[model samples]
Target: MGDDSIGGRLSEFIGNLGGFLRKFIFSVLSVGPIPNHIAFILDGNRRYAKKHNLKEGDGHRAGFVALLSMLKYCYELGVKYVTIYAFSIDNFNRRPDEVQYIMGLMHEKIEGMLKEESFVRSYGVRVHFLGDLKLLHQSVRIAAEKAMRVTANNTKFVLLICVAYTSTNETVHSVHQCFKEKRRPMDKFQEEEQQQQQQGLIKLVDLERNMYMALAPDPDILVRTSGETRLSNFLLWQTAFCYLYSPAKLWPEISLWNLVWSVLNFQRAYPYLLKTKMKRY
Candidate 1:
């Protein structure tokens, strides 16, 4: 046999072997306890598009398909709550054309979620939109509302989609609502100050009814794609102690195997984490 032929055969063999190993590892990782609520900062779509030399819209389309696959894996792993960072308020600063395209894509995906054949319906998933709804385009807002209304009755799993969202905005919104409920007149700063002083302390329960995620449990794990290490203003109040993982893959490249790996890593670290919590108590 020629040297070139032999080298080609060897490369194929190694590639196949690596693929098998990855599948085996993913299977093993999926067998253990899964988190009840997992959040994701779906990043790198634009970068993925650039690298692939595709249109900006194509990257988001690919990411949406990747998300569907991840949702299926989450259901299979018994995850009851999944929160995804679909769009950030910071995203609004992008080029107007790009942002418009993304908004259109968001509408399309939300509409798609309402289809009977959607994986969300098959898995009995309830959908919620968590964000500043007023900032979105009217069409996108309606699509999101429709998706939530249609899936409101599903009981198996909960999916929270964050669009036009920022942790700072969520916190400020909660505080604003809290004050509004007390009916403290904006003109009466002295009275409001006295009332706050009299209250003495603020607690999570006090803010519960004011926050957007009031009914949902805090996420147990938060995942970010494209190897980003920062929270990027996602779920700040709720993720006070959530485990965080940033895998090296872009949003469009995330797979079942990556999800499994993150879960397993969380499991390995959890016992130590519990011990630390117990010591504090």
Candidate 2:
């Protein structure tokens, strides 16, 4: 055989072997304890762009590609819920043009969800926009609604995109909703009469029920890209027992190995996390 042909065959064989090995390891790791939900703080996109001297939104575009790939990995590992902080309420403070670019990107992505991408259909992933809908642009709001409507029947997996979201705002909104929903057994008059009574006190369940992403459980693991360790107003109420992982890489720079490391960290704390959950219940 010619050396060129021989080299081609060998390279192809190696690639196939590598894919098999990755899947095998992922399977083994998932056998013991898999995270039911994982939250991602896709940070440092702008920093990455500046570091590479790329255009304004190029880093975010690259980050979106990384997100799509990670979604596949999460699906393979049987993660039921995946949440990403796509855009924070604070992000609007940037320059008007920059904010407009981000909103346009979000609108495009939400429109893509309505088309039911192959991965979405394959995994039965239900798309959820977790934020104040009224705060979004009218066009984006319509697109988000359509995406949710298109994926409402899916039960296997859930993909939550937090746009225009803030933890403090979520908490305040939940408090308002608690009264609107009448979560407590006591009536308004009774609650007023005995404000100090346990019946009038807000319970954990009441607050949780009113949160934007109340349908899914709190994230078992929260992966934040970049060197920062703070929550940055992401899932504040749901992070009490979450295994927070901050890799020293930008959002677009994160890879499957980063996810594996995050999973390994979660595995290390599995016993304690499980005990905590049991106690809460």
Candidate 1 has an lDDT of: 0.85
How would you encode candidate 2's per-residue C-alpha lDDT over 1-281 as one tens digit per residue?
99999999999999889779779979889767889999999998999999999997998898988999899889888899999999889988999999889889988877765554567776788999988778888899898988888899999889998988999989999999887765547666877876656645667888888899797988999999897899999899899888999999999999989989999989999999889978977
Residue pairs of candidate 1 with colliding backbone atoms: none
Question: How many Å off is the CA of 172 in candidate 2?
Answer: 0.8
lDDT of 1 by residue, 158-248 (tens): 9998989999999899988876755545456767776777653455566877788875877878999999999999898888666889999
The lDDT per prediction is 0.85, 0.88
Candidate 2 Cα lDDT to native: 0.88
Give per-model TM-scores. Answer: 0.82, 0.87
Candidate maximizing TM-score:
2
- What clash count goes with each model? 0, 0
